[model samples]
Target: MTLYLHLGAHKTATTLLQNVLKHNEAALEERGLARIKIQPRHLFWHLYRDGDRDAFKKRRRTLARKLQQYYKSWPNAVLSSETMFGTSDLHRVNCLYPRADTALRVLAQLTSGMNRKVIFYVRRQDNFIESSFINRLQTLATSLHLDHAQLLSDTTWCSFEHYLSSFTPSQLSWLHLIKRMEAHFGAENLIIRPFESIHRGNAAYAESFLAPMCATHDLELAPQVYENRSFSAKALEEFIRLAPKQGFANLRSLRLHLQDKYPNTSYPRPMLLSPEQRQEILQTLATENSILFEQYFSDVDRTDISYQPVGS
Candidate 1:
């Protein structure tokens, strides 16, 4: 069976894509495909976090058996998860997805001998970093299941400037992540998409993400249901100030409450970086972006990937 593994650089509409696949399971099955859902924690811990080789071997074998069962039902399947790359907590100012290579290596071992194709969505480095910072803050506030010592660390909740200050703009390179992916999953097997292309409030946006993974543009997709909307700027500031004071359960509940109260659609996204900084981020990566486009996206419409700041 051919496995389409969607390794998300999060904040790239990954959750919405996952939901659409689940909603359209019947449609996919009719097309000789299926969406195989796995708990994020399983991959995060067993594959990415754990260093126990013997334990990981046993776990990998167990997961392989589970996947074989899925393949018995459907000849082609997609396994989608951002955690397949690494956890949000791994993000630091100086390093982006520091454990990405390790995680990909572990995943490569798990899916050995299978016809595996990797599906990835690349976002602009500036926007990607800002969004990831907001996501980390959200996780810190709501992830009560994590150990308090780790979860409550000051660095985890540090200001966006502090986070960005840790790494030079030149260090923010998609090439590093893409190279790691190619090393493990062959360059020919990668289906990379620019996140900006179909992200312009398109109702059928999920189709763009899904069709590539399923290897069919002729899919009959259900209506896209938006999920995991970003918190508005005002809401984010208020949430941050209040988050440190609340207990975990309360903070989690508050986050849910605020999601409905101040969805990104209703207000501007949090602007952690000034326009100057945003430009610096873009200028710093211009050559890198050009190389990325020239190498991987020669056939596609290169104009759509300006990595322009939203609402600019």
Candidate 2:
């Protein structure tokens, strides 16, 4: 069977895609696209890296059997998780484990004999950094005693800088993850696209994501789909502000309050890098992005990467 792994670099529409596939799982399976099931924190060794060393390996045997079952009956079997790309840990400064060696080794073991395809979505760095910060801040606002005022002081540039520093720009780029996966799956099996392009034509990202893979295999995806986009910044800010004033017990009530207030308007986005800063960063990335485009999208005249495709 062909194995399709939809990895997320966080802040992408990974959850929405999962929710849609979940909605149409049975029909898609009948059409030869069975999504491999994964436990929330287990598949990618998230809990294992968090110190519960016992959580990941045990599940691999069952997953391997599922992979075999797909090999026997299905034309195309799929797996998807944002955590697989070391994304869920973005909120924390220095996580227990930033590397994904254990997860990768386990995956390599489980999908041993299958033709593996890796698909990932890319978002612009500035927007990605902002979205990631807001999501993390919201998670903290609802759960922990965080310094929301200080975080809100001026802009989130410093916070974003701190996060980018942890991984460094080179590591933050998907080219890094793509190279790592290519080591295991090879460049021919990799399919990378921009998060924005996937959502083009007024289609939901989830709706557009699976259809193409099906077409490549001469199969079709289920027509029906679902979407669960992330929350807006206004709602997040309200959550932080009201969580303390109304107490954590009343956090839900406060959330309803903000949802009613803004309806659809997102809060103002954080300070993006200035033109000079952006130009400098792009200069640094020029060669690397060229190499990435050369390796992955050589035939296409353009690439999803922001640092202009080679020979713009």
Candidate 3:
């Protein structure tokens, strides 16, 4: 069996892709592909061999056995999980797919194993940072009382510097990550995509990139998938305003609690900065995220892609 794994680096249209796949599951199945649905739809740990401790490991060995059973039942499976990209626990992953390689090494390992393919889409640093901040604020508002200014000021809240504390600039840079993964996996086995190209109303970009893998597995492409959600900057500001008053201490707890309260909340709009604020935030990000930004921009220029239109 061949596995097509999409490891999201976050805030890069993962939800869009998942929605597309889920919406077109029937078409995908006709093409000899399966979405591998586990109950609770959003949860992916059910597919891994290790029981999810965060969810109480309810099924434990039974879940793992079921996953293995399904895995063996199909010749081609596409498994996706954004959380997989954030985790540093190699043991948890190894336990699931014993022969699977790390995201940084999966490309080369695919040649010997069940023909593996890794697909990753990355957003430019500036846009990614801005959007990520709003995401954090909306995420924080559920539990804590937070406003835009406070969230921006709190180093522990959301900032390029804070993220760098956990992941090195090199490790976090998509260009570097791709290079390292390609070095181990073989360039042919890895696919790198820019966020701009995929979002440019070109629904075929995803299918084009996945075509080779699909052909290898005798799978067909589904019809074009459209985005149902619209981007909103105003909504983000409102979320930020509601944050601090919510009284949650950290983002993690705040997110869970917020989901419980507003289960249907969509992506908050991008926060719009005034001219002065935009310049100030840009300068701050540039200074605080110098190493990472430089690396990230260098890759952007080399790739010759922009997530937004000129002047946007």
Q: Quick one: ranking by TM-score, best first?
A: 1, 2, 3
RMSD of each: 3.3, 5.0, 8.9
Record all residue pairs in model 1 with backbone atoms less than 3 Å apart, i.e. clashing: none
lDDT of 1: 0.72
lDDT (tens digit, per residue) of candidate 3 on 1-312: 666667665666677667657766666666666665544323333324244656533443444454455457766667666554332221112121222234334223323445666776666555654555545455443322235356545656533344424332222234445656567666666666666665444355545545644442332333445443322544433444455555445644545444444433364545444455444434543432344334433363335554332343
lDDT of 3 at 244: 51
Q: Which residue segments of model 2 deviate by more than 4 Å?
A: 88-97, 141-167, 202-208, 216-228, 231-233, 243-276, 298-305, 308-312
Q: Which one is best on TM-score? A: 1
Error of 1 at 44 (Å): 3.2
Question: Per-residue lDDT for 87-115 in model 1, tens only?
Answer: 55434444556777766886787777888
Give lDDT per model, in order: 0.72, 0.59, 0.49
Q: After superposition on all CA atoms, how large is the RMSD of candidate 2?
A: 5.0
